[model samples]
Target: MPTRAHGLRSRYRSLVVAAVAALMAVLLSPAGAQGAGSGGARTPLSEPVYSYSGAVRESVWVDTGLDGDGDGRDDRVAADIIRPREPARQGRKIPVIMDASPYYSCCGRGNESQLKTYDSDGRPVGFPLHYDNYFVPRGYAFVAVDLAGTNRSDGCVDVGGRSDVQSAKAVIDWLNGRARAYTTRTGGTRATAGWSNGRTGMIGKSWDGTIANGVAATGVRGLRTIVPISAISSWYDYYFAQGAPLYDGGPDWLSGYVDSPEALGRCAAVQQRLADGAPRTGDWTPLWTGRDYVKDARKVRASVFAVHGMQDLNVRTKHLGQWWDALAEQGVERKIWLSQTGHVDPFDFRRAEWADTLHRWFDHYLLGYDNGIDREPMADIERHPGQWSTDRVWPPRTTRTTALHPGSGTAPGVGALSLRPARPGAAETFTDDPAQSETEWAADLDRTTTAKAGFRTGRLTADLRLSGSSTVTVTATPTTSTAHLSAVLVDLGPDTIRDYGASGEGITTLTDRSCWGASTPGDSACYRDTAARTAAVDRTVISRGWADLGTYASPGKGRPLTPGRPVTLTLDLAATDHVVPAGHRLALIVAGTDRDLIDPPGSTPTLTLDLSRTTARLPLVGGTGAFVRATAGSTAADAVSMAPGARGVTPPHPAPRVPGDGRP
Candidate 1:
């Protein structure tokens, strides 16, 4: 009963079985001793083990679904890649570490002011920062992308809009084999990311990190995690603060600043859209919504390792605070590092610790390594310069809002900040003066000034630690339809602190260089070392807020008030975590027109505050009972003079550095 057809079928089955056995034998041999990474390549330690000098370096133009330049073609993003040449040639796939930035070409990056350089064949030779020098030699591929409309890319600058986000996301798609790319801008052959394992980690600072946040919000499949350092979550918060323009004509100018030279006359239309969409009246338009990534955090598939400076006045702390809160609400995996510096990258301030933690984070997430990062504390906070501590979470979960009311004091406008409310109809008044800054308004805490109204608590008997955002609710009557108000929470005491208001923004760059990873002729891992800039100060502004009375009702809508009519305006203070020592007193200064932080308003109006109605809700570690006990040993004299009343020197750096803040 053995038919010829049956014999042929049996022979075929035998051949298939033999082939599978041979394949399994080859896979399980001694040649497969590449460690136990489920994702292919493996990194055994926190240091680089693979070869960096022999890495394969190349460039590609990935196609994107954007017509930012309107040239009848899709915009192509420029990406420079560096990976281990031997492993990549041997058909070994690896995960990617990407940094997509607009600053790569125009302003440079990091402490050294480095820009990417290419060789004769248009292959990358010089890579900015230590990312390539460090990670490329650690079984990882480093990809530095020029955001659309910047550097060698083809497009118009859209700032944080669709073009900027989609272009970067398209590169991840290509790495995952879902999109197309080519060797050159015009054409050559198709460039395939065949050596990649479709896993990526994005890391950057400032606008570069912002792009990472934007891409992460898209829930991009290949993006495993993001390390956004001092990044913005919402573009609206960057240029406008609650319907108040932080400065005039922000969108268009920033777009043109980062755009390539080729985008000269071609991007006028895009620039016009930016200018037209962001109305001066500060209305929340469709343009800002497109740029707001915080609202879309629920769609994020990537774990976030957020690092922010509590004193980062440029991008501000609210961006990270709100973004982190949103991420937590979604129950996303997160870790945080809060520094006492300003607008600074941790690599420059806390180099060793940051590098080690970053290495472990990438290993755990992207490489499927069983590192104990999740078991470690969730927060690494630089409590003071050269001092760091860890916590289970940020803002310490024990935080509660303690409302402190302002009351009458014997020293004229110098009022008292206390748990008990002031008598009804006890009002204080001040005229808006654009000339006086927060520095001037906060000086001489016990003295009366026409420029501001001050309230201070008695000398604290115990340490009070504030760890979150604060809000000031002002119940006031304005003399005119247009009114601008400012509130500041100050730590009124002398303390040796890292001078965040110093010329270096709390970090001084030294000429002496330190190497992090292996160095090549063109690109080195060595950078100028930095140290903390310390200062002796009597008073330090802990947190501050500003409000345009026209937008009192809502942040999106601006409505003018009736002259002499009272309106309650609540504004958000910047987030913070500071410890007021046992002897220092906490003070709240209410003023008009914060000339140092915000642009001057058009009209100057005098405002009268109903002390009984106005109050500050602080995020103290413990509630009112804690505050009452801390300041229990209080007297009228202690209230009159804030503690640590030493001779204070004026810091060299006093206000926000505009053009300088955008760089580095």
Candidate 2:
């Protein structure tokens, strides 16, 4: 019987309100409507209540208790079949929705109560309900499964790869056999929809999302449309932003996989095991090429609707771009939505829209309804200030770029002067003190607050949106063979801010866009001095078949450079989509590193910038020419200074202080 817990429903209702309020404050504030009634109708927090008070007609659990791997670990697992509360008079073979999740199953009790609940008064009530609720009444059955290594399931945790695939096959086989004995409408046809980490859909948010992408790669029959919300295209890319690994989220994730308290107490055990597992050992190696979803995008025949949050710092918006690129390359028919909040936000403010989107997708694919989901734009877009646009393809045609120049003596505090290309007259120079501690465009890694001889650009009012790959082309004469130069795009709105670090790649802070590509790919011929060193390795094996492969070579030093010719450094900024609006002047500050942003070696130098010969090519939209004219000097100084309550720019958190360097 479904028992609607009024207490839980009330609490969840409050949560829905709170989530909307927070999202509105962040996203809908400038629209002049800051309250509940202003935005679109908020979706109800809970799903429609369903009753299971009458006879279940059919219910059974199959044993998944034995360890298939024969690793001496027995496991417990099972799935329950729930007949539709209402069946068609004329038997109809209805579709099935298989909800696969990593969450522990309370021996089928918890899973059943998720969709159908009752109040203390014995009245049915649904809380945190979803699309699956409408299925039963429409002659459909749902199978909720406990993935391997989860509650009552066997085998070690496989994060949605082979383990999930095998599990899905097992559950599907079981469901098909049981449906034959039932006289209800759902006793015939089948399909799947996974929520969260459920493996059924092979795609959706979090675990479910990744698995969907993986499952789709297999081209499983009967597997149709996959609606992955905020899913990761590549596990490596998800866990590690670029080369730097994501430390915080990964640990939280491991805890859930081994749900038991005792299993959790074995944290060190699991940690060690996983370290020896595939993820940690890979280290961005070529081996990951096997799991690269983008490479197999063409093989993914299932229709897909990938939804992502534009401001999702945790998941990072880069995944959306990566997926978009892959789908484009495959020429696959796909749908995408760029939501407004962070990862997995509640379905309140944009509830109707989200529900409508999902309903249409499932209806068209699963139920075979022609709901025009195909008629919509391929790419669902969102710009600033409630501007929601759509396009036949991603990275809309209007994604334009604008260049901001870095000039001499450009410190956080110093105002930029009107810059014009010099007649090749003089070259600016300054000593780079590696020990002095410097900051990148985004961090405080170095102790020094600012460096000497940097440059910046003035302000503008038009919102600047740059997508895809961006490069920083610079001409520099390094004093050392291995020199590191950083270029930062500072939001000179009202905050002198810097957002850096590997995690900082997808985040839109006051400023970002700093990278180091080989100055000339491999300009080894220019180097004059060189040195080499090597280390010996020793290995020993443990009784448990574990062996440490001893030490590998320590990082070696590259050839040093002689102090003569100036070379151009082409730095590849990670592909990002950010808009610096009109009123907010985009300043490009150049320095050794943003002490607050990057952690360079203790031996690199803090050098000066020569802006006289520097050039920038900014993509201007609806404007004439290939670039926007560089504006510096007094006009720039007045435009790009820090002020309070500045419009168009997200205010800096914790506030920013002027760097205590004399150059400014």
Candidate 3:
């Protein structure tokens, strides 16, 4: 027989051994040993978690501060939601993907311009695009909200102002249980987003995507990531470049154009504020500063996935370039996709690959899956149609800024662009005509009666790649107090380029259809096919820049110039990623006015350019070696050997510069 203390010690040892055996059993089990968390193995994005046909659809209205309709009550933002039925029925929480747009019931979305479709009970049966049809089966909820003052939402269109951003922010607050939402505009029983897991991601294109950028800058709590495609980071950049207005009208006109449901007269106050806020001088005011997301990039905590077309003239590449630079300065995690198409959706350009990539991104961020996407390359650049290259960084880390100077040439108003600056020659002069368009200015470089000055590099022996923004600096004297300055970069190669014509931006609609998702009665799975509009031309305008000489010193103040007094003007051209192919020449055209893009002054001004002091600084990949190898035959010595008064030869039938001033 053992003593009481001895018996107690023996029992404790037996209990410890039994517990260890039980833990080992669990570790050896196949189902329980998948992952090291209580949540078990992570769900794969390719696996369907719920029935697509059985997803639930519902609608609610979130309250905002504005009384847009002036009914004496706060405005309401309408939200339409679609989610898997199994998750909602079983009380299991799921993540949310939201798109806040003003075009749902108006201009529509994507290449086809598809709008929202409703059922008999006024519930949304079909959400525009394939987001709802594809993501519902993957255990995520898709919510589409009508921005305040558009479609079913109750408010005036503020045009990316406070109301536009707040309406979207209110929805995110409600989803996270921080704000209140109701079924009707005036009053109803309060509703809670209990089915949501409080994690949200926003994605959209153009104006819709703009809202995403605006909201993310606010540093909202629940928003995990944002994908802004061809989006505007600054409203001022969209309407004005530097100190010049891109169009005649300001944000007032844009507000009226986008506000379809509300009568124009009703929102006259808002529209008036918009017009007054954006002065004709193009100075930075409180209104534009409030709308600029790049300035507030430090407040952003969400990861960004930016997409833009290098040839996009509507929104332009500067918006993305500046915003991307700001984000990088803050050490934010970011990814980018740069394409050659003009203002086009990636779906139309790279359908299957885009879908798969987007799916993986959403799964990793929203669903907490440990996918290897984040460790992969951060950029995917499209060199040509259907040809893409991935790199660890955007703009390539090896890029360097190289300055090209105007050298002696025989042609009037034409010269060779060489690495060495030439001695001062007779200044090239051109009269600014308000009636002349960009097409007429670039038609013939060597024409005797042209209103623009052209400079070019000789036929390239190798490919020269330009990867970033280009700057044009000029020292000139103007005949008038005010003048408009325009600079264009041209690729003078006899090849077919993307035709961003007067009607459409390098896309033509066809009768045939292609499908991306399952179909319902309200929403069709198929859409019309589109073909790339290509044009065979002698020279293609790759990028353009403009400035008003009056606002050279400060955009807020205009100073009159003394007659024949030289003033230096520097203009930043749009960012680009293009390869000037072998045997092709890179041309730079400097003109006084761009009638196609901006409103011209009342009087014409003659500008005399100091060719010796002028230079165009370009960001080229591979530095000086690339430039030297490309122009080995036509050396700087050749440029110096040209006779002072010799005329340059002209290429016959130069391509017309496409008109890009108007709204898309």
Candidate 4:
């Protein structure tokens, strides 16, 4: 999301100026600031002090309100207009930009500690860093509003996304009409921008991202741009991958929303705002409006600049695919950036870029600023091993498909093998005891251990990149009536994985998974309706497909150790971004459960993995399926490799022969 890393680029220059100002005020006044002398006028200003960098002048506050929805509740808002102290421009109402968010009351404007941290470069870094000084000095009139239900704003917090939109409109109206702090020579509306939790555009990412999407889709006139950074397009998939219910992430988020510190010390009262299991209301209710953002993202008419993490665990790139498809159908001006960094890090930078991008967009559409933003590439993908490429659009126009065939004991067999196809009829089987409670792949524990088995295509010799589905088909027979199977696709080694996903089955306190069909209620299952299940009546072949929940059922009246009866677990591997070196190998691991990356111990039904007949289908690109040959090594030093994208390639990264962790 971020165009630049935090602090790497200056973001606190204004605070330093403010500190100087406060110091001068201390020296010039009867008493010095920071208690340097007998406390001068110890009276704190009723309103926040304002300043514009690059200028000697500072504008005071102008408070105003409007009936944005005409509901009688005067939504009080504030603005600070900063012009160059030197001279005035002729007949030009400067384009205004502001961020409307619900992070805190008064949009964090009244905090003095926020004022002092502006560094020499004009960036605000400290707790009280204000946007007014940063943007206003740059010829922008900045306004920050206290969203409804906070401070003097009216109405309740529509966590479902309604009040925020109304507040945005009212703030805009006030900006155009009665902003009392300064006079405007040129007259027209201005641009708005925000980052992280702010209500800027229908920007996607975490919770704020979702609301942005919802807000923009409303087609509100003032909403000119959307930057959904690591936002969840599909709530269900955001929480659970491969159809495994996220039993933890949901409740924790709900708890935070209900008890946000803004409601005084009434955490309990906030928690009680909506009873557990209470249906969501307003524009967000699909049942009422029959319009779901996931189902119809095209409703968002605003130009969008979406940012996604290639390794975002919580909000997978797959969700970004959903957004892409919708935006494409809408034919809206859209661009996507897939990066190698973590969600939060990228997002922080994305906001500034978003702010800049919106400025150009509004200038072009609203103010007629021809910044050539539309001429930029439609997609920017940070490819693995470190490189960046631009595309006119995503799913690249020149993508070629290849298949990888799976085999036993790392050896090539006879007949034609796919470029990246599954070895037909090949299977692996193993026993899973839910009672054992083992660790799984990556971070989540739901994919706990039965017997960890993985296959690797020896190092790419050439860069191996895939952007679609990765699947595994296993014929499994449960000693018990039912089994729970979770599958994950990891980049392997230290550099491939990014930190943004759930690490275990236990309810996570940081995110929500309702859209991904993983909901939690007080640390218990809230989306049990989607939990995998099976029939207890017969010893049948239950072909439970992956990309959805696995089965959980009583094996039968007796434990069916009948061995011969076969069941199948078709696992849908999560998408990945890996750069297998000339010597490294690409590995696919299968387990009864990956405890670390999936459900926790004693929390859910257990799954048994049968490795004997497991088969994986891998997609390979470049050339007709059989252009390359593959080989495996019995020992580390003897590992295989290809003649640099020539054909059968061996894994570049050597796997330690002795398994340090029993669970792959």
Candidate 5:
């Protein structure tokens, strides 16, 4: 029916049309090997606009390139991902929110203690914490990674050493197409981060948060920001306070607590390394340098949103204090929140406010939104339970270090602290008692005791605020070659405060529940409410410090004493923000081993101090003149009673005894 030339032309045109259709399909497939299709980028709104419960879920194993357990193969870290399905269906990419932690399979997370659960196909079903539920619908992907040596990963936990930090970094590298990932641990099939936009932000609490700090210090390219809550800046600070061992066998103990079956089979050599590195000696070691993130602050390019409890005895405030100062020195963009609680997360302290603020923070950094969070004050400090105040920066601009000298009082071992120096030859002495504690020393403040030496300033006419860490310098002659000293600053008066030592560590969980985001039958966004637990106390320990007499000058080595020879040592106290009311006196007590707080010295040593050479440097809101004016006309004669208040004294510092607590 057609001529020869016309038939040839029609078939040729059909072949050309078919080729164009095939090329387009390959370029636009959402699950293609190349990431972030050539589609238009999605602009983010201030509110959620996608599905969370119906999010796409998958699993991958990222290679860390380290045989930490001597398995003769590169280690692989397991990463479980949840992302909005709408983006994948539309062939668009989304930003990532990652949390790399050893606790995903061990101790659990949040107030409800939720762990990761798996579906029949081995994909992650119940992702712990509320990040997945809240952010996925906001066009973000949440990746919950099981750190090396824990859960389904293949390696040994190095306990904040090279392996722990790098494993997390590997996942970040994979998202940027710089590292290799596999669909299974066996590693025959390759997997890719095709859903990622290559921008990432990390968020976590405690040890989980600690990994965020370590990885950021590596100056990784994809990391935009980090939120580390109650985390450690230096692993050395966690086990040793200054040069005193808080506990022995710290690293190995934690590693064993979080190990998986795969790790247990090959981590023998790794365990031995930890023991040989930390020898129960208080002196600094090379192992500590490898774990210290503060020293690497210069390498950090990511902005920080730090949160910490003012009274957190576990990770302690010094970690945040020193890290904050170091970050500031490098001019890293930062924001902070100091709570009145102890080792508690803000989600439990201020739920709705924390969620909204965190949401906006992620939006500003990851989504490139023009939120005014960066223009606001840098710090939010809790003045008291349920009362929060903002400041341009911490330790107000007027803060100055004031030196106070001690002079003898009417009673033995009791003294009055004043602005002027004491007589040159004046001295005070006390014997160390191994069985004594700060609680025992505080209770007998008015009476005479050989267990400790007490000093106090006159009652105040107006409020006096102390803003940061204080240092105590004592020139003493020890009766033994080595000794231990505990110094505590106190506000001697009656006041109601959060009971941090209680079971909940400053909060009581309520029966009622509140939801944050979308929920499914297996995974719910609902969490129990919490309330502050208060206690009326006669005196509050404002700040405390511990020191081993031998390691006074250097954190690396110890200086042995010649029994009766005079030696000078400085004690570094914990950081705090507190106000001494008009009716209260500011007091200091120097004593022996703090019973349950730290390990006791091998033998009790008696020490004699020359009051003339002993002084304390307090970080007061203003200089000496302001402090003198606040206590204008007041004298030692106005001291308040040392007895307990309407409610008895609060309990001692809480021990990290919870089985799955994930403490270092």
Candidate 6:
């Protein structure tokens, strides 16, 4: 044996050798060096490392700052949470993807009508829709919240008002440790979202999506992004169009429709406020201003991913159009998907593509992955059914407003639309009748005694694509103190169009079922298939606009017109992305009172239009050059003249009549 000192020196030398060897090995390996460094190599976001089957499911009641139910306690929003079990087991925090909705227990979501399913202990074993199943496995915590008064939450249903919005905002706050929540409604154990990372994203469709928009408008922290599909930007816009009530019963009826427990009388106070607040004259009030998200766009800090069906009549396209415009104005980072289907989710339309895109979006925003999604095109528009195109910007930056003039044709109640202005003093007249529906007024194109005036352009030499909102400038005088004006843009083509204006909003219930993700006994991941409701007709109404003539200058109040005094009314039709094919004529139909969309005036009024001053400005995407070149070669002498109510043009076929229910 060696001496004790010699043995110690030998052991120290051995230790030094092993340490040097280990350092060298680490320095030689790039991956090992990266792992050891302060700035570590990032894990690939595309990998599916999280297990969906091993997710932990739980519930919490978030406190909204109101006693909506008048129970002398704050309203609580019920949230069903599903997250990766590994995160909580390993003491790791995960970001949240939330869907706050009122349809969790009623009416369901999407075309298939999906409802939430719970286990025996009231804990959610299976969440409704595919959001929880698909995202939970992708390392995201999915929270499906039951809006106040819906599901098992405690509150009166306020529709899209303060209670509805605050219900969602409170959930987001609780996730970020800013709000109070409990394990039960009144006196249960306290709960904390300690497993959350305080970063969240909100998404949903229809009313669910509207909640996303409403919550984002509050600029709450922890909400990083939002995806609102077919959402409502303004409650007034949903039920009214330019100061004209679009639906009856206003907010009260809608509040009752979505509220559950079958006892709407429980929320009678809330419903009464909605009814009492809504002015029948369609004038804007504090109630509407409080619910208008577009007006509060500046408060939105979260990035937006907006989707809308061009033919969605239930929520209408204006909700997306105006909201998108406001977001752009605010310089909010945004992406858009405009589809051809009516009120349909992207998953139902383009399943695989939607899944991939949404996955990548979550990876980039929530996972902090450096994906190139933000660098891609800002807009994806469905040109036709099952066909999509990308653009650098929405509404095409190259779009120009082209004006088309109106003139009388050889037929009675028939007129001509031209690219040039009509002569001075040229005018047309129509009488307002409250009982007539738009379809009835448009039924006889050549009839002279109808309550509407029709003007059509000659057959197009080339295809005309309208990509944005069209404006109708009417110079008319009302015989009475007030009158309602309805402007319609018609596609005079004999083709099948999506009849979203009809009941059910063009959704056809089918017996066929399609599975999306994993299913449970309580919540099946399967959904029924649906087809577009269509109609074959001689003419298809592309878009329409309504205005309470008295509220022309301001939406809040009316300015009555003097009898026989011409006043210019500039109204904007719904935005569209449609191709008016060659040989099809575009028509402008101006009528009084669209009974299908709004409550009619109480009196009959004769309205006279000054055709010389009246014009329709269309947002032509690419065919403006062709139109200018085509019209440049012609003169004013080419204007067509027709008698009133002549029998030259065929009437449009009877179709669904709903206010602002025009095909995109």
Q: List TM-scores for all candidates, in order.
A: 0.91, 0.58, 0.87, 0.57, 0.91, 0.85
Query: Which is the winner by lDDT between candidate 2 and candidate 3?
Result: 3
Model 6: residues >4 Å from true position, as ranges? 1-48, 262-266, 409-414, 433-449, 499-510, 531-535, 559-561, 622-626, 629-664
lDDT by residue (270-293, candidate 1, tens digit) is 999999998777778999999999
Residue-wise C-alpha lDDT for candidate 4, range 111-178, written one tens digit per residue: 11112222365322232222333333333444443444443344444443345445455544444443
| Ten residues in sequence with the least summed lDDT for candidate 3 | 653-662
Q: In model 4, what lDDT does residue 618 have?
A: 43
Model 5: CA > 4 A from native: 1-45, 410-413, 641-644, 647-659, 662-664
**Cα TM-score of candidate 4:** 0.57
Q: Which ten residues in a row have the lowest lDDT in candidate 4?
A: 534-543
lDDT by residue (455-539, candidate 5, tens digit) is 8877888899898779999888889977888888888888777788776778899999998888988789899999988777888
Weakest 10 consecutive residues of candidate 6 by summed lDDT? 29-38
Sort the candidates on lDDT, descending order.
5, 1, 3, 6, 2, 4
Error of 4 at 442 (Å): 7.2
CA lDDT of every candidate: 0.82, 0.42, 0.76, 0.39, 0.82, 0.75
Worst 10-residue stretch by lDDT in candidate 5?
A: 29-38
Candidate 1, after superposition: displacement of residue 308 in Å? 1.3
Model 3 residue 589 CA deviation in Å: 1.3
Clashes of each: 0, 56, 5, 107, 0, 12
RMSD of each: 7.7, 18.2, 8.0, 17.2, 8.3, 7.6
List candidate 3 stretches off by more than 4 Å.
Answer: 1-43, 67-72, 260-265, 410-413, 424-426, 447-449, 635-664
Q: Model 1: which residue pairs collide? A: none
**C-alpha positional error of residue 569 in candidate 5 after TM-score superposition, expressed in Å:** 1.3
